[model samples]
Target: MADDLSPEFCAVLRDAFERAGYDADGVLRLLGDSAHAALGRGEPEPARRAARDSGALGSLIRLFLLGDTLPEREVRAILPWPESVSTGVVRVDGDDVRAGLDVRPYGDDQGSWWVFADLDSDLLGGQVPADHVLGVGHASLSLARATIRRPVGSVLDLGTGCGVQALHASRHAQRITATDLSPRALSLARATFSINGLDVETRQGTWFEPMAGRRFDQVVCNPPFVVGPSRVDYTYRDSGLAGDDASALVVAALPEYLARGGVGQLLASWLHLPGRDWDERVTAWLPGGVDAWFVQRDVADPDLYVGTWLRDAGIDPRSPEGSARASAWLDWFAENKVAGVGFGFVTIRRTDSEPRIVCEDLRHAFDDPLGPEAAGWLDRIDWLRAHSSPDALLRAHLRVADSVVLEEVSASGDEGWEAVVRRLHRTDGPGWQHEIDELVRALLAGCSGALPLGDLLELLAAAHGVATDALVVAALPLVDELVRHGMLVPA
Candidate 1:
């Protein structure tokens, strides 16, 4: 029996899978709409039934997606029996075949790749082992969509469970270094890259432990930032560290490991402790001379937070075991005085000047693959920083962004009508809305990039009987904010 991996083996396997039409689109087509929906809700029976008659495709689905036992003859038809047996991926038991690893197809807009990890909770039907490496999940997808895809010299995927982030980084980065605390996770990640015929350097370490004194042009991580009492069940989600300390450690250590002009994007959860501002608690983690933006997507109270994580670990919330686990989690949170948990994305860019930190709450849904939007934000921040002084800003020619639309709130009054508020709404890309006064709205609407901002402000001041200096002073701050948020542009 052959156990070793080679180019020839991978190519043959790829050809066979292609011939069987085993891919994301293929699986969805075979399963149809209803069964696909059922699988998404963690119910796989419908999918199993749907694919039971699809021939080789059915066998592939049963083996990988459903984790079912199959006849040895059928298994060998898809997988090389000698090599599969030698490698322990599948075993023979009474003329039946069973898998030790779960392999599935995952893809993004760029292309497709096969991902290998421990069987999911639905397939395992129990608590995942402590060292279980997770496959594609909400966290990994969030980080992937949030990662900046700009081509770079090098990138690091910290805590690279099953290496999905690293795999995504491979599309843009010339070189990728992936690290994981669990050796098994690292091995599995290596296998994942090998199967795809992509090269990535895998290191065994926790967080930044393996890359001492090294730096990267870009760093992407989906760390074990879950706020928990302990790391008892799974290493993929829980960090053993006290509430949100793992995220804190990552944030604190980033500046030292990021090259100048480097970018770091991470998905993290932080505790909203009582009597503390969420922004303050999070911004305190950033070191000096790094521009940081923290977009808090959602917040959950302690009870909901604990219960959600418990469910994520495969515990049924309505079951007796779930009740006990939830009680323990809540008790620990109460003892620690955690008021709530905040989940979001943190983007940091290393710069020379003092860090510009902006923490905002955006709870509404937006488009994914936010890398370009994020890169735009950092560029706008740099432009705003250089134009911090009123004189500098007023001398620059500006244009109102096309995506911005002016909207006003009004109410009927004794004076016939009154305007309560004027706001700018962005039509695309995160869709931010901002409130503006009459004067600022007039200035922005009138901007054509032909006249300098100082000249426009002076003309407006003359027409309104206000001092030009005061007008410039009052308008520059709001203009800067609008520019930084991409509502306005420098022509």
Candidate 2:
């Protein structure tokens, strides 16, 4: 890529950003909490008012973020890097200076970093170009939060837009390679890595082509998984494949790129067809010898999905062109017998034993930064695999997760008061809630991590006047399900 972005220029840029305190915290401080929240909602007037009197940080925010032009002298005073103008980072028209690209502050719990990408379509007052590289967005952040961020020897960020995923991977991975089909995207990714002072290898190719014969310890992809007609209008969202094929292609090809025991996490979309189970369709995409978890976060009908993506490209749904596009999209959906679209996270880990794949819809809001939960889930899968037999499971001690809470429901009837329902609720990590019967409830109450599960089951069987073998057989599967959902854990 960006051949003009020399190391010296990037180094100078990083230093200038640090000196001016142009970071996540710095930006928040400059624009009070209200104004910052307003800015995130896409209303810039509040931020504009807040920055009118602020100094260099204000000008920096205006130039890079708010898409405002500033006095050339003021920009030069703050940034001594003459290469910015020479390299077309900004255009100088007489006494005015305007940024040519978008540079914003992004960070996690660790520290702050900068992301470089093309200006937003709102700033441009038009649809983005075909090869536009997206900055940090909801999908990218979702994948980042959902990734299992264990320390690894190497990582692969497939279809890295502005290298946001790669940037987060740098915190734990020893080495990383970011790839994309668009050269402009790769160029921006390279610039992002350079400015962050991270040693990431950038390659240009589609999907796995850039990393032929290479296996990575971790692979993270946010592919062009938008489901629609087989037409390519934008590179970031359209895969030019009909009806969710892009997502399926990536999932099918993942096994070849992951090393044994390595993990791959990606964001994907799939279609719901009439009389066909969505989970089964997606589950069939995975090859053998891998444990997978699919969490569907949202579902959109055809009309809503089409309208949302159309407006995302700056097209008004009422416009003639928008109407024509929608008609064609709906026609495609009708021909394909598509019912709806499902979007969510997919985490797969290569394994040596028989694979365990769980697919379910988790639409409830819960705690974010689910990386730790994801890692714990993979470990629990291994533990369950090691103890697949009844005897092995009975010999182990189990405890309810600290975040789990028990709720009992009751109603007054002719017999005064009677229990109606009982449920176990996990307060964190997707907040899964499971209804239980008296037997299961009693069994969970006895799981204080003090005795073996077999002993506890034996005690429950004696109290309930049921056979020990029968209770054990019935409780084993329930315990396995609870462990998988993070409602229970090993002592």
Global lDDT scores for all candidate models: 0.84, 0.89
Q: Who wins the TM-score comparison? A: 2
Segments of candidate 1 deviating more than 4 angstroms: 1-12, 32-38, 43-50, 85-99, 230-232, 318-320, 414-418
Per-residue lDDT tens digits for candidate 2, residues 1-491, read 25577777888988888888899899999999999999999989899889886888898888887889899889997875578888667778899999877888998888899988887778878777888778888889899999988899999999999999999999999999999998888888888899898999989987899899999999999999999989888898898898899999999898788999999999999999999889999998999889999889999999999999988877778999889999999999899988999999899998889999999888878876677777988988999999999999999999998999999999999988778899999988778899999999899988889999999999999999999999998899999999988887899
**lDDT of candidate 2 vs native?**
0.89
Clashes of each: 0, 0
RMSD, every candidate, angstroms: 2.6, 1.5
Model 1's alpha-carbon lDDT is 0.84
What range of 10 consecutive residues in model 2 has the weakest lDDT sum? 1-10
